[model samples]
Target: MTASAEPTPDDVVSAAKALHALTAIPDHSPRWSNTAEPTQWTATHTIEHISDALLFYSGQVARRADAKLPVLRDGRDAPVSEHLDNVLSSAHVLAALLRDLAEERAFHPSGSADAPGWAGMAVTEILVHGTDAARALGVGLILPENVCARTVSRVFPWIDLTLARPPELLLAITGRFSIDGVHSDPDWWWQSAPLVEWDGLPRRRDVKPGWT
Candidate 1:
């Protein structure tokens, strides 16, 4: 979140492991006490979506500078177990690439992103979708404040760090919460551009220059 706490490959790895705990695959038991948040999709569908996203991001991150992005496989029809594996494998691959070349810049969505940006994005997918999966399983999964804060720091650098709360603010800027006058008629879109020197404060979409 701070200069000393920039996200790394290890951060992504740990978030993946947290997702594993939510799914209850390895333990072979139901964890109704998930303690996380919620989403609209079913558990199976949500997990599948996250797995595909993880794979896709891995593909983009693995691309060399100026290299074309690779086509990734769709695992939506795979069993939930396989989807879980896909999530973990892709996360590991992304982690390795980020670990090696985190500082190297690459184009994503017409803009370049640094290593922390990638890592934060991956963690966001896991934590948010993982919470959805957990909730559909009749459990709640609350993310740690530090993890949520770090994720915001990376992807949503526009957030004001001073007015932060763990999942509440995370969900708000992620379009899950309705912040007054902030604007999310559809949903809040996170920026993927390099934000190395940008001010870490909330940006209001409805406010305009010389209007207020």
Candidate 2:
């Protein structure tokens, strides 16, 4: 994913659509069963992590307007096909919820962190961590160029586009990997609070140093 244009909700959906194809890949393959390279989590565990994170974000948006979002998990311990199904389903649900919340100007907070630009957060996970899972399976997983570019712009404004490709940059920004003269920094973070002024929404008292 190296496109330069900003991403839209449509891009998020298309990325998820791309992820759905993983279900068809044979789970019995050694790659699928092996531990994810460059990371401790297995391919199945990484997919499960993605699914659960999306589920937690969805809860933040769909739960009561004034309620503090609870940390949630999907611990089914199911087979590969079931995990794939869970990932696809969770991604679709999160995409739709993000679109709706952004459109309606709804309040969505994860703990004390508010995510007005929810689409960027969702797309970032799909591309960066999705790559983690795909690579572990010994499969190629290139995100749509435009989607990747948009995520980089929205979430990692400090990075120069010329420094590296968008997907690689995104991973580095999230502290997932390092690149030449572009290693992950200790203070990396995304603009999760309202990027624009949205009056009457609950916001954090102050900006935190850590990444969301």
Candidate 3:
């Protein structure tokens, strides 16, 4: 992954819009197929997960805007529907924050295990989770080249590539890879041992509970 291009506020907004549009698809279609926990999710549940992520991030942005250090409560195991609403609401908050502070420095509270800065983190989640939702719904949503390029670039620094995973696989773990055909099996793990010795490569690992 490259780390040169950084998305402008417009890029972030565009990505969010694309995600919302993709999630608008009807829930009962046969096209939707991927699921993090296949036995637990349907098309509706996938959208809900996206919504949940959006909500969580948006709240963080809001707290930041208020000059308060934002802390994300544990919602990893929350139901997909609850998380879906969160994702939607959070996307709106994130977009608003981008618009309000275009040049704000990136922030990652102490416990954030995901992306580091605000823009990078937002782009990562929107791009990756959006892809997950789209894949589950069997909808084809294309992220803007610039957004993906920027994300692919920035993602390298925060990740540990030694896990011996492909760029897409790493992105899938971080929730940035949005293209189709990526698997969501929770049991499959991509170990980072092989990629550890590669020069200049970021460290990454694939654990249980695939895309959610």
lDDT of 2: 0.63
**Per-residue lDDT of 36-84 in model 3, one digit per residue for the tens?**
3333465555565555555555565555433334344444665443554
TM-score of 3: 0.54
Query: How many collisions per candidate?
Result: 7, 0, 31
Task: Encode model 2's per-residue lDDT on 45-151: one tens digit a residue.
Answer: 77777676677667777662454456656555677778767767877787677666644433333222233356677777677667777877767776676677777
Q: Give the range of the ten consecutive residues with the poorest summed lDDT in model 3.
A: 188-197
Ranking by lDDT: 1, 2, 3
How does residue 97 of candidate 2 score in lDDT? 70
Looking at candidate 1, what is the lDDT of residue 36? 31
Q: Give candidate 2's error at residue 22 in angstroms.
A: 3.2
Clashing pairs in 1: 34-140, 35-140, 35-141, 35-142, 36-140, 36-141, 36-142
lDDT of model 1, residue 198: 52
TM-score on alpha carbons, each prediction: 0.74, 0.75, 0.54
Global Cα lDDT for candidate 3:
0.49
Candidate 1, which ten residues in sequence have the lowest lDDT sum?
203-212
